[model samples]
Target chain A: MRRLLLAGPDFSLAAVDPHSTPGFDGGKKKGAAALADGGEVLSSLQEKLFAESRAGSEIAVLLVLQGMDTSGKGGIVRHVVGLVDPQGVQHHAFKAPSEEERRHSFLWRIRHQLPRPGMIGVFDRSHYEDVLIHRVRGLSPAEEIEKRYGAIRRFEAEVAASGTRVLKVMLHIGRDEQKARLAERLERKDKYWKYNPGDVDERGYWDQYQEAYQRAVERTSTPEAPWFVVPAERKWYARLAVQRLLTATLEDMQLSWPRATFDVEAEKQRLAAT
Target chain B: MRRLLLAGPDFSLAAVDPHSTPGFDGGKKKGAAALADGGEVLSSLQEKLFAESRAGSEIAVLLVLQGMDTSGKGGIVRHVVGLVDPQGVQHHAFKAPSEEERRHSFLWRIRHQLPRPGMIGVFDRSHYEDVLIHRVRGLSPAEEIEKRYGAIRRFEAEVAASGTRVLKVMLHIGRDEQKARLAERLERKDKYWKYNPGDVDERGYWDQYQEAYQRAVERTSTPEAPWFVVPAERKWYARLAVQRLLTATLEDMQLSWPRATFDVEAEKQRLAAT
Candidate 1:
């Protein structure tokens, strides 16, 4: 999965097929079964991570999701991270910066939302927006846009050094798939709230957005915080692959429950009398 | 369920049997199945509540869970609230106050954690702790403690008036059940971190704590924000009851999908062209 999805030196978004389910040969039925199976594993690992936090362990995990409209970023959050204890999960969705937010450095708002120890933090859209949208729409100067890549690299490196594992995923979906999704939203009254007219304007910049994503992934996919471009045209595959990525990242942490801080036997005796 | 669980004018903590499942007739097997089924209904209601928020709906739900240690408050958070999209749930587990927190009003920290518009807020332990622990442990003067009940009553009244429904629940567990839970924690290495030695000390004051709870519930149970004393000895019953309470509260809101602000047909035509 890593070999297929991880953005390498020669990685290009155009080369990866959004419809392909790499590494997993299973069809939809097997993918659904695997996802259900993965939920239990993810929940247990998350609990251990949370338990370790009680012992003052500084470890945490951050998942940064970047993608176009209808790329299933919200789906990954709902289907994947939803399997764990909500108490231990810190989920944030970054919209356009508020007036107060724009007053600070781009990383300032991002820094404020980093997970506390022993949490799995998820960003629906994150710091990459500073480079992606800014570059695609000329929201920032050429030199300024050029510098955020190094800034993000340094920021993520510091985050890793502080015991937070950063997992960055970009959900890759085809233009046709996006149009279908937007049309479905438009057609369904229940989905109308999610149907934004601005999304159609953004669709016109599909190639520019793709170029922006390719550049962003190329510049900032570091060893500490590598980017995984998941094929997201098939929603099930996208959800399953991200779940595997998250579960595997947690497994690699190798966390265990913190030992009792007090004398267990004595506490047992005391508890009995109570 | 409402009639069976709601705290009324004649409510008494001692009269309510913690072992009895008042509204639910089924045993553990049926209870588990019911909980699983309820997750689907709860998830749908929660999503509607969230979607409504996007279109400027001020509606929200605040679940305040207050109980003795080992009363399965965390279990409800994991099994019940965990069923919903974490994106729409604001969960805050209040520990003992920090030096800074102590400097402000008890409600200060609580106001900060209240759910934003169109969110479900869960407080693992809530402002009720001020009355329960403070009265039991004499953490505050009798006069000041007396004043806080009215303060909380008025505060919740304003909270409800502003479009947030507050559901206060006290997880009622017998002393023996708490002792068994604490002993189990000490018995397992994986559970050791949850075994706080101070919990045994707290158990010594169980009767006083119950009296504190009785008085708090009596004083604060109002029409706007009623308290529900959930018999929590059966973990499954407690979880199912809370899920029902949350689902019912959300259903009462009668939220519908926000109408599209844009011209759907025009947007569809534009989207197709793009």
Candidate 2:
């Protein structure tokens, strides 16, 4: 069975430098059409997976999407997983912690949003923010921050044991790409509002964040909940990779239509009378 | 603005029961081709509306779906509102109250799920159930139930005053139609799993529930939140009515795109360097 994992950096032309290697050219070279086809396949497979989840009443899937500022997280969710049955899907977009969320353990909000049976839950940004944001801002003591890595792994393992399959993805984009993307947003009158001045300060810590992500990935990518390094220079490629991973995961589950027990003739008669 | 409500008996088969007025024959009859066309139009309109909501960052829309067992609430949500951007849309399916929910006010759970600016929130079964279920089950006194009608009106008024537009729909089907649907479920092997003997007991209270629902609708259908009586015998027609109602509500909001503020020349330079 193929394990489900998909992660990438957001290097969209709207947010990244057009000349960046992982930009449009990377996407085109990676076979954009093939990626789109993969997306279509994923959409078809998701329907069956959803029905099976409802019928078999088995495992749940958790898709973790993480990226830097202006990463195409919103766009990917909009275009890719948008086709799935909303009733069978739950989306949790993590934002800056509220007063209540901050008062609890870091995992409290995530624990509350965990998908129920027969549901696929998508986390826009997840627990890793504890490391990512805290590390960057020096919010937590170094020792405590390091300790969280093990905590996350154990928490995820417990979730896996309880019938939830976790897949985490890290979007990798270069500084040049980020600058270009930010520039585009600044240039476009319509998109200017999305360009936050503070992002430049964050850009200064880009390399540091990348190293941190790489270390986090190496440490936390376990058998129970693996992390995929998605090459996201190309939006199309990233989208396709995520879709393929999701499709393979569902296919591995070997979902089948549950057997129906209704008598067709009786139903036909009922329909006729109705 | 025209209010879109979905009020129909659970299942009223027109072919079997010629006396069924809840069937789609009264409105524009939607055949397969028309259904497909309407779906396309609805999909496009919903997409546009979602974009407008995200860009304008002002108005929010709430879709309230009420129906009996197997009334196609899930199907309608999957097919109709499925086209909107997930970032700008949220789906909340209310279930039996949890221990915590039972401890709080009836409106507590619902109050928390209200859509933020620039989003559409869908309620599979909403607050009206307090009146519908509690009345039918005799969980509350007649005086308390009457008081709830006022509470509902006030709650809706508060929401609407806060710039949230509510579209309440009551899916109406006839008893014979419901029987046909239930029989179809029982006859099909795959669908048999969905049938419960308890549903029949609930079906027995159909007239009483209808009276309760009628009273609730009559009392709570204020200018802020009007209810529409939708003929749900035809799934296609029901979907169209919902789409039309949604589009009209969005149009009433007068949405527009947010202004951008990027520097084009500098962005081009940044892109060229990337």
Candidate number of the best DockQ: 1
Fnat for each model: 0.91, 0.39
Q: How many Å off is the CA of A112 in candidate 2?
A: 2.3
lDDT of 1 at A45: 96
For candidate 1, the per-residue lDDT at B22 reads 87
Q: Model 1's CAPRI class?
A: high
TM-score of each: 0.99, 0.80
DockQ in order: 0.90, 0.31
DockQ of 2: 0.31
How many angstroms is residue A114 displaced in model 2 relative to the true structure, after the best TM-score fit? 1.7
For model 1, the stretches where C-alpha displacement exceeds 4 angstroms are none
